[model samples]
Target: MSTTLSKSYYHATSSVSLSAVTTRDLLDSVAKKTPEKEAYIFPVEKVRLTFEELQRQVCTLGTGLLSIGLKRGDTLGIISSCAPEYIMVQLAAAYIGVVLARFHVGLPNSLLKSALLKSECVALVVGANNDDVYNQLELILPDLKTSHAETLQTDEKSKLQRIITNVEASQGRWKSIYDIMNLCKKDSENGKQRLEETSKMVEFGDPYTIFYTSGSTGPLKGTLHSHMAIQNIYMMCADRYEWTNDDILLSACSSLSHATSEMSHIAPLILGMTSVILSPGAKIHDNVSVIQNEHCTVLFSTYPGLYNLLHHGKINEYDCSSLRYVMTSASTIPTDVIQKVSSIFQAKVLHTYGSSEALFVSGRDITADEKEIIDKVGRPFGHTEVKIVNEYGKIVPINTQGELLIRSNFLFRYYIHDEDKTKQVMSVDGWYTSGDLAKIDRNGYIKIAGRSQDVIMKGGKTMYYASLVESLLSHPNVKAAYIVPVPDEELQEDFCACVSLIGDTSISSDDLKDFYKANIGIPAYIPKYVMVFDDFPEMLTGKMDQKMLTLEVFTRLGLNKEWLVHGRKA
Candidate 1:
């Protein structure tokens, strides 16, 4: 472990004393009460699992994990499609007190290697069905390199010694899905007995999950979150959203890769609701079908995925009367898009804003007049204390744009093994610097301006990517937009609009330019250019990689030779 600690204002306000129960405890609690009640329903496969059955499988595989010498505080890398057994592994890790770090399988080989290395994962668990992933890992095994490889691996002999568990097992190391389920059935007979012994040993505040933050600057960083932190976040968000035991939930976004799915899954599961797991490779068409067929009442998706759904024209065909709460985060949700979705689905469309370091800081009830709260990220998620602070750590007045800082019981434990990186965001006192700039109105509603890195300055006024992109997304013909700054001889930097048009909806550059000039309302003095791409390059977690886009533009525009700011002069 790293010895350095960075000062965060959040540390002074509170301690990491949140109470959390192990996954086994949670499953056992639900099993004892819900018993035969259905907890998960895989609508596509027509498969279902009762609480008792789910708990039964968890304990046995937990034994499978332990049988391979897997111990508490060890990390397991899980890369697979959404499966009952995959979920079982996560539960089993929580049950036995091992931390589960789920890797995004869709990431490029290089990025995936970065995550695996950064997490120092002892054993990697990939699904039997995903043979491609298995092959990819094997293909790159010997060549896998990272900064921490040597420090993370050694053949020391001690009871406290750490080594790879999943990959090094003499037997059952790469157990198949069928193998685990078969063993789970055999262990069901002793489930009750095993549960009793493990229940007494598990402790709250122990690390249960290590979620990697979607890095925009470099490789992703693993953020360690405790079981207690998970529970607190789940309870807070569930209460604020009025999530009930009966609500059917679905996530079109990468729930398996994000903290939203990480924490939000707890509520419906703990409350005895049936969770519908959308299949991998699920496009916009599949999403509509899943909601209609599964009778899904709540859907949590990112802005891009939702936008894709709207543009595909499949949303209106589905009988989506079952939906009640439709929440979006990760990126800004357009007001016009929000209003259209609400009108079509007749459900509440909520726009939420936060990060992996801090989940659900604020949300707006964007059920009506999407424009009203579209610019605003919304009010803080129930009881969360938010402040706009300047560089000196002093609070800025309302409506003044500054760094958005948050103080909540739900901050992450630490940036996993990266103290220097942890200090960059968290203060020793107890506040988390979001790296986002925002302002609050007298009504307590918060409106985001842009990310600190994404803000562009022209003349003396600053133009936020969020506001600029929001304007482009408002156009009926535009599907998605990215405002990437490019090099300029006059103003040091100019704005370039890279857009993805609606599917089958064609409009020329001149048409777009005319529309922007008439509708966007930007200053004429600022240099503006438009480039249309089939699709923007996206990070593994599905967020736009503006840095990559900038690099590509620099090369294409012949500006890389002398441009500052890598691609744009600043």
Candidate 2:
């Protein structure tokens, strides 16, 4: 029943004075001590914001929000590309205990509107150049896109298309970014006074954000978190990962995902480190340049993006020797991908597993051995307890694969209003069932197999789709992979892999099958069919839509009759 961190290596070696401060207090303290130290690096434009300056801007925006009668615990809808302004607004909302109902600008405007309306956002702040956002809103009510040229990217083909599609000239309700900033800046002198008012009675347990599940499975639901959750991440990273204020962290990936929400956004900001924020519409090439030019010490990216960087030979050319850590999350990384990326960048890559409902559970610790790195996600950090359980919630034996249930120092309030779904998955006894299946070794390192629903049973042997997908993704030519279990008259169920390869790479399906069989140690089960794709259909958060991929496979190969033998078709 205890939530306190056990007296382990973390408790024995460290001074625990950091426990007293919350995330909001951490930001305020950093602003005071290192006001002029660079707080953020803009990788696209090479712009950097000092800690003090960032706080000042946050305060100004906070005052502007307060003047408009926003209150604590009120949700503020934010949809914009990554910018210093975005960071400013995020911090301002945190300072006032405003729960951030964050939405990525890339999200379909229809989905964005639904989420906003559901969160009941009292106020909204957006980038000046978001014509797409305004146009989408204009279909319902009057709004304007911000006309700031600097915030808008001119050359990107996809970005331009979005802009054109969303902006309607006839609608007059849109507001300009210039006008909003001007008003906030004019009232900058009173920003601190506003921050004081917001923080006067705020506490560590107060809710600060409500991030949505990436919606890979179903409709997106908001997961509520308190400042205590943010502080828990900061403490765990500092206590275990050797993070410090001197580290220069670059989050080229958007901060909306569950992994980046904790790692890139909260970890660096609360630790008083220099964070490099990517400009909206920034590319991977721009990230390489930032690493070299900005002397980025730490890097964070998704599994596919990490592979894409290495496969394109971008990592070899960049002078990123200053880099010490590279982390990937939301999915597992292949051993081959890690070995190549490590050799090229000369930095250790860490893999972590968690959910939007709970921040972090198990991570591949840097200090752990190669076997721990490859075979398992490392031991739990700080006050987190990981348990492997059966269908009845009974604890499973070590080295036995079961659903991963996490009991952490922090947990989300609820999944918005979906109380039924919340209670079904999140146990009242402090455990949140991850829906992911993993086996805990005797040493306590956990190896992820696949999601419980994603596991396929054939002839009484369970085949993990993710384990197969991880193997295929390790191939040099495979840029990304998806595995689908289709019904087979011979085997009951069999897996077929769909892969998106690197451009102009002429690797054949036979070659791929041989590669996986040789490397992964399973020849007969190495995917009966391997289909290649040029690009993947992704949800707004950049994670591949497996459901859509499966549907495509169903249509192309007509596998629906094969797989839907017992269960109804979705």
> Per-model C-alpha lDDT, please?
0.68, 0.69
Over the stretch 200-264, how does candidate 1's per-residue lDDT look in tens digits? 67787788788777777566878787776677666656666677777878866654767776644
**How many backbone clashes are present in model 1?**
17
Work out the TM-score per prediction.
0.86, 0.86
Which residue pairs come into collision in candidate 2? 35-52, 128-146, 143-173, 143-174, 144-174, 487-562
**Once superposed on the true structure, which residue ranges of model 2 sit more than 4 Å away at CA?**
1-23, 140-195, 254-259, 470-479, 510-526, 559-570
The weakest ten consecutive residues by lDDT in model 1 span 1-10
Per-residue lDDT of 1-570 in model 2, one digit per residue for the tens?
012322211111224333545556777788898888888777665567787877766666666666556778787777666475567777877877787777766666667667766677766665555656655654533222344332222222211111211123424342333343455566665755776877776787888787888887678888888888767765776566687888888776754434355566666566788877776477777777788887888888777678667756366667898899887775466677788777778888777767777777667667777755575666676677778878887777777778888877666878886899889878778778788888876566778887888876665567778777777777877877888777767766777788888779998888887777787776545787788888777877877887777778778887664355464221
lDDT of 1 at 26: 71
